[model samples]
Target: MTDQLDDLIATVQEQERRLVLTRFTHDDAWALGSLVVGLARERGLPVTVDVTRGAQQLFHAALEGTAAHNDVWIARKVATVRELGTSSFLAGLQARARGEVFEDAPWIDATRMAGHGGAFPITVEGAGVVGTLTVSGLPQADDHALAVEALELFRAG
Candidate 1:
């Protein structure tokens, strides 16, 4: 891997390490979803947020002015998290660095999974990946950062 990609992976890994929760509740999803909306509104970003645990979608919304296509991106990114147990940004980087498209990658179904930014694994302290927090409608990197930002802010709260 390139140094830049390595650094980006490490940065996101650090976030995963720092934000492990002891327990996750439906209430936490609401809290996180609210903060995500706040962050987008604060930045005047047209975006969509989706938070889910297992097959259960807890909170979801698309801000006015966001493209309908963002919902598709959100689903694809969520599939990345479900299958990879890593941030979509990192998986996308891995695919790009390998000179491959995500759909052609063997690990997950191309049609269902996406190797792009905007999705993050929600991990529990000792339970590993339990859910996802995803955002779409910005540049890939920015979408990933927005999800991370909401998690960080939620952590602080």
Candidate 2:
């Protein structure tokens, strides 16, 4: 990995570590989901962010739409907690580099797939992928933009 990738990963990992130790709620699913969806739309991407755990609560409805409510379907396991060192995340980076969208592409095996609606693992050098950053319910270019924007924010902070 390049020096810049290393540095960016380090910074993002530090932030994730802080959030974990502090039990921060700001980075929770609802909050992060809103940010991802809003940013994607701001970038002119059609977006729908499903919490994948939320029931059809009023709050859930207000957050995005009925799809945001996690109760309607067999909720995929929530993976909000940061996981920078996992093989799952590592594969995501490699897949992205190959010009393939792993999560949304159904051709990949179930075990190898990213479970979230469409998450792009944010990866950096030594730190690896810090978390699942996603932007979907849109065109490929728009989806990529959402992840890119999230990575930019991660790097900035």
Cα lDDT, all candidates? 0.87, 0.40
Q: Write the per-residue lDDT of candidate 2 for residues 1-157, one digit (tens) a residue.
A: 5565455445434543433211112344456566666665565554544432122211121223324423321122113213323223333444554566546555544433343333444344455444444444544334444545554554454
Q: TM-scores for all candidates?
A: 0.93, 0.39
Question: How do the residues 5-34 of candidate 1 rate in per-residue lDDT, one tens digit apiece?
Answer: 778878877887887887778999989988
Least well predicted 10-residue stretch by lDDT in candidate 2: 53-62
Model 2: number of backbone collisions: 0
**How many clashes does each candidate structure show, in the order listed?**
0, 0
Error of 2 at 34 (Å): 2.4
For candidate 1, what is the TM-score? Answer: 0.93
